[model samples]
Target: MAATSRDVAREAGVSQATVSRVLTAGTPVSEKTRARVMDAMARIGYVPNRAARTMKTGRTGTIGVVVADLGNPFYPQLLEALSRSLDASDHRMTVWVSDGGKNQAALDAIREGTVDGVIFTTVTEHSHELARALEQRSPLVLVNRTVEGADCDQVSSANRQGAGLIANYLVAHGRTRIAFIGGTPLASTTAQRLGGFSDRLARLGHPLPDELVAHGAYTHESGCRTAAQLLHLNPGINALVCSNDLLAFAALDTAKAAGIRVPEDLWVIGYDDIQQSSWRSLNLTTVRQDVAQLAAEATRLLLARLDDPDRPAIRVELEPTLVVRASSAFAPA
Candidate 1:
C-alpha cells in the first residue's frame, strides 16, 4: 500500500496541515520540520496524488503547449527548455502538435479541460477558432505567434530586429541582389521577420524583387522547393535570408546540390540559431532567439495566470541577436 499524507505527517512528527502548507502554500516551515518531512516521505516513498490535489484545488497543475511542426528543430529546443522550467516550478507540461493546420481537433483540446492553460505556437490567420475557444475558459499564452484581435498573453522574439540585422550584414558585404525564403506568411514570426528584412533592404537601397521573395511551409522540403524557385527566378541572387534554421539548412543543401559555393558564390543566412547551426558541417549564420529565456519567461507567465486567472494579459518579447558564421561570411573583394 502507498503511504498517505497521514502517515507522512505522523512520521514527521508534524501536523498534516503543516506539511500541506510547506508543499502547496510554499510557506517557510522551519528547516528541522522540512528535513523531517522530507525524510519521512523518502522512507515511506510517498507520492502526492496529483489528481486528488487537482480535485481539491480546481487546477490541473499541468500546462498545455501547442506547437506547429515538432519536426522543426527550433521548436524542439524551445519545448525542452519550457518543460525544464515548468518542472522546476513543480508543474508539468502536456504538448500538443498542431500539424500546421488550424483544425477543430486542436481547438477542441484547448476548449475541453485537458490542462490548466495553453502556450500556442505557429498560430495562423485561420486560428480564430482556437483564440475563441481559449478565451472562453482558460488563460492562453501565444508563443512565437499571435492572432489579430485576440486578447491573450504572448511571448515571442523580436523577429523584426533580428531580420534587420541579417539584412544589414548581407548588404554591408556588398551582396545587393538578395532574396528571402520566407516561411508560412500567416505565422507572425515569419511575417515580422520578412517585413523587417524587406523594410531594411528597401531603406538600404537594395530592395528585393517581388519575384525573388518565396514562401514555404516551414519544412525542409518546402525550403528546398522554395529555394529552387527563387534560384530559378533570380539565378544571380547573391544572398538568401531564410526565416528559420531548418529552412536555411535546406537552402544550403539545395545550393550545394546545385554546385553553388556557399559564401563564396552565394551567401546563405538563417534564423533561430538552432543547435545544429554551429555544427562543423553546417556553420550557419543566423539570428539567435534566447530559447532558455523565452521558455522560462513563458512558463512564469503561464504559472502566474494559472495562479490568478483574472490577471491582465501580458506580452513579452525578447530581442534576438545576430550570430555570424561561415555560412554568411564574405571573401575579400
Candidate 2:
C-alpha cells in the first residue's frame, strides 16, 4: 500500500495535522518539525495530493492563462516564457484560447475558485467576462493587451512608438506609396500600431491614405488575403507594414506569387521579431517585443495581486526595438 500522511505522521512521531502543515506552503511549522516530517516522507516514500491541499487552502497552485490563437508563434514563445516564470515560483499554468472572443468556461473556473490567478493575453475593449472578473476583484493581470476602463495591472510593449520607428525607417529608406496591414479591428495592439504608423507618416509629410490600409486577423491567411487585395487594388504601393510577423511572411509570399520584386520594388516590415523571423529564408525586419519581460512583469503583477488584492492597479510597458534585416533593407552586396 502507498504511504499516506497518516503513515508519515506515525513515522515522524507527529500529528497528521502537523504533517499537512509541513506539506502546505506558508503554513507555520517549526523548522525542527518540518525537518522531521521531511525525513519521514523520504523514508516512507509519501507524496501529498495537490488537489486535497487545494481544497483545504483554496489555492489550486495553478494560474489560468487566457490567450488567443496558438497558431501565432508569438503566443507559444510567450507561453514558454510564462512557463519558466511560473515554474520558478512552484506554480503551474492552464491555458484556454479566446476562440471567437468568448471564454466562458475559463471564466467559470475563475468564479469557482479553481485557479490561484489569471493572466489575459488577448483581452479586448468589449470583454464582459473581464469586467465581471474585475467587479469580483479577481487576482488577474493583462499581458500584451489591455481593455480600456478596466482597472487592472497590465504588461505590454510600446506599440505606438515601435510603429513610429517603422515609419521613420521606411521614410528614410525613401519608401513612398506605403501601405499597412493591421490585425483585427478591435484589437488594441492593432489600433496602437496603426495610429503610430499613420500619425508618424502624416507628420513626415507622407500621410497614409485610407484605401491603402487593410485589417485582418493575426494569421498568415489574413496576410495573404489582405496583401493580395492591397497589391491588386494599388500595384504602385512601394512598402507594406504588417501588424505581426506572420502577416508579414504571408505578405512576402503574396508578393512573390505576384512576381513583385522585394526591396527592388516593395519593402515588408512586421511586428514581433519571432524566432522564425531570423531565418535566412525569411530574414524579416520587425519590431522586437521582449516576451520574457512581458511574462516576468505579468507574473510579478499577478503574484503581487494574489498576495495583496487591495493594492492599486499598475501598468508596465516595455519599449520595443526595431530589428533591420533583408526584408525591409537591402543586404550588402
Candidate 3:
C-alpha cells in the first residue's frame, strides 16, 4: 500500500491539514515546516496522489500547451524554454499539437478538467477553429501571436522593430531591388513585419513595389516555391527577406540552385534566428528572437492571469536584435 498524507503527517508529528497545505502551491506554509514535512514524507516514502490534491486545491498543477506545429526547429526550442519555465513554477506541461490529429484530445483535456490553464503558442490569424478555445473557461495566454480584442495576455517579440532592422541593414549595404516573402499575410506577425519593412524601406528611398512582395505559409517548401517563382520569373530582385529561418534556408538553397552567388549577386535576411541559421552551411543573417524570454514572459502572463482572473490583459513585446552573418554581408565595391 502507498504511504498516504496521513502517514506523512504522523511521521512528521504534524496534522494531516499541515501536510496537505505543504502539497498545495502558493500556500503560506513556513519554510522550516515545509522542509520538515518534506523530509518526513521522503523518509516515509509518502507521495500524495494528484487526483486527491486537485480535489482539495481545485488546481491540477498542470498546464496545457497548444503548439500549432512542432516540425519546425524553432517550435522545439520554444517548447524547451516553456518546459523549463513551467517546471520552475512547480507546474507540469501537457502538450498537444494543434494541427495534429490529436487536437481533439487537447479540447477534451480542457473539458474534462485535466489542465489548470493553457498557453497557445501559435495563435495566428484566420484561426476559426480557435474561436471556440478563445471562449473557453481556461485562463489562457497567447505566445508570439495575438488577435485584436483578445481577452488573454500575450508575449511576443518586437516584430515591427526587427523587420525595420532588416530593411535598414539591406539598404545600408546598398541593396535597392529587394523582395519580401511573408507567411500568412493576415497573421499579425506577418502584417507587422511586412509593414515595418515596407515603411522603413520607403523612408530610406528604396521603396518596395507591390509586385516584389510574396506571401505563403511559414514553411520551407512554401518559401522554396515562392522564391523560385520570384528568382526565375520576376527580374531585378537582388535582395530577399524571408519571414523565418526555414524560409530563408529554402531561399538560400534555391538561390544556389539558380547559380546565384549569395552576397555577391544577392543578399538574404530572415527573422527568428533559429539554430540552423548559425550553421556554417546556411550562415543566415536574421533577427534574433529571445525564445527563452518569450517563454518566460508567457509563463509569467499565464501565472499572473491565473492568479488574478479579473486582471486587465497585458501585452509584452520583447526587443529583438539583428544577427548579421554571411548571408547578408556586403560585397566590396
Candidate 4:
C-alpha cells in the first residue's frame, strides 16, 4: 500500500489534521512541529493527495494555458518559455489547445476550478461566452491576442510597428508596387499589421492598391492563393509582406513556381521571425518578436495576479525588430 497522511501522522506522533495543516502551510504552525512533520513525511515517503489539498485550499497550484492552433511553430517556442518561467516559480502548467477559436473545452476546464489562473492566446473579439466564463472563474491573462472591451492583463508585441518596419524597408528599396499576403481579416494581429502597413505607405505618398492586398487565413494554401491573386491583380507589384513566416515560406514557394526571382525581381518579408526563417533554403526577412520575453512576461503577469487577484490589470507591449535577409533587397550603399 502507498504511504498515506495517516502513516505520516502516526510516525510524527501528531494528528492527521496537524499533518495536513503543516503540509498546506495555509496557517502558521510552530517551526518544531513543521520540522517533525517533514521528518515523518521523509521517513515514511508519504505523498499528499493533490486533489484533496485543492479541495481544502481552493487552489490547484496550476495555471491553465489555452492556445489556439498549437501547430503554429511560434506557439511551441512561446510555450517552452512560459513553462520555464512558471517552473521557476514552482507552478505547474496545464496546457489546453482550442481548435481555431473554439474554446469550449478550455472554458469548461476553467469553470470547474482545475486551475487557479489562465493564460490564453489566439482568442477572438467574438469569444463572448469564453470571455464571460473566464471573468467568472479565475484571473485571466491574454497573450498575443486581446479581446475588445475585455478588462484583463495582456502581453503582446507591437504588431503595427513591426509591420511599419517592413513597409518602410520595402519602400526604401524602391519597391513602390507592394502587396500584402496572409492573415485572416478577423484576426487582431492581422488587422494591426495591415493598418500600420497601409498607414506608413500612405505617409510615403504611395497607397496600397485596393486589389493588391489579399486577406486569407494563416495557412500555406492561403499564402499560395493570396500570392496568385496579388500577382494576377497587379503584375507590377515587386514586393510582398506576409503576416507570418509560414505564409512567407508559402509565398517563396509560389514565387519560385512562377519564376519570380527573389530580391532581383520580387522581394518577400514576413513577421514573427520563426526559427525556420533562418533555414538555408528560406532565409526569410521578417520582424523578430521576442517570444521568450513575451512568454516570460505573460507568465509573470499571471503569477502576480494569482498572488493578488485584486491588483489592477496591466498591458505589456514589447517592441519588435526587423531582420533583413536574402529575401529582401539590400539597402543602397
For candidate 4, lDDT tens digit of each residue in 1-333? 888898999999999889988866467889999999999999988888888878887888888888777666888888888898888888899988877544666566666878777788787767776567656846888898776557788888888888889888877778878888858866778888888899999998899877778888787888898897787677887888888888899899999988988877888999999899999799999999998888898989988887898888888889999999989855333
Q: Residue 63 deviation, candidate 2, in Å? A: 0.1
* Runs off by more than 4 Å, candidate 1: 6-43, 100-113
Give the best candidate by lDDT: 2
Better of 2 and 4 by TM-score: 2
lDDT of 1 by residue, 1-333 (tens): 877788899988999877676676558788888889989889999898777787787777777887778899888998999899989987778887877553445446545655777777767866656656665755777777766556677788988889999888888889888888988888887888999999999999988778888998888999999998888778898888898999999999999999988888888899999999999799999999999999888888878887787888787889999999998765456
Cα-based TM-score, every candidate: 0.88, 0.94, 0.90, 0.92
- List clashing residue pairs in candidate 3: none
* Model 4 stretches with alpha carbons more than 4 Å out: 21-35, 134-137, 330-333
| Clash pairs for candidate 2 | none
In TM-score terms, candidate 1 sits at 0.88
lDDT of each: 0.83, 0.89, 0.85, 0.83
Candidate 2 lDDT over residue span 1-333, tens digit each: 878899999999999999988977899999999999999999999988777777877888899898888899999999999999988888899888878554566667777877888988988778888888789888889899876657999888888899999999888878868999998868878998999999999999999999999998888988999999999999999899998899999999999999998867888999999999999888999999999989999999999888899999998889999999888788222
Model 3 per-residue lDDT tens digits across residues 31-50: 99999999999898887888
Candidate 2: RMSD to truth: 2.1
TM-score of 4: 0.92
How far does residue 162 in candidate 4 sit from its true spot (Å)? 1.1
Candidate structures ordered by TM-score, highest first: 2, 4, 3, 1
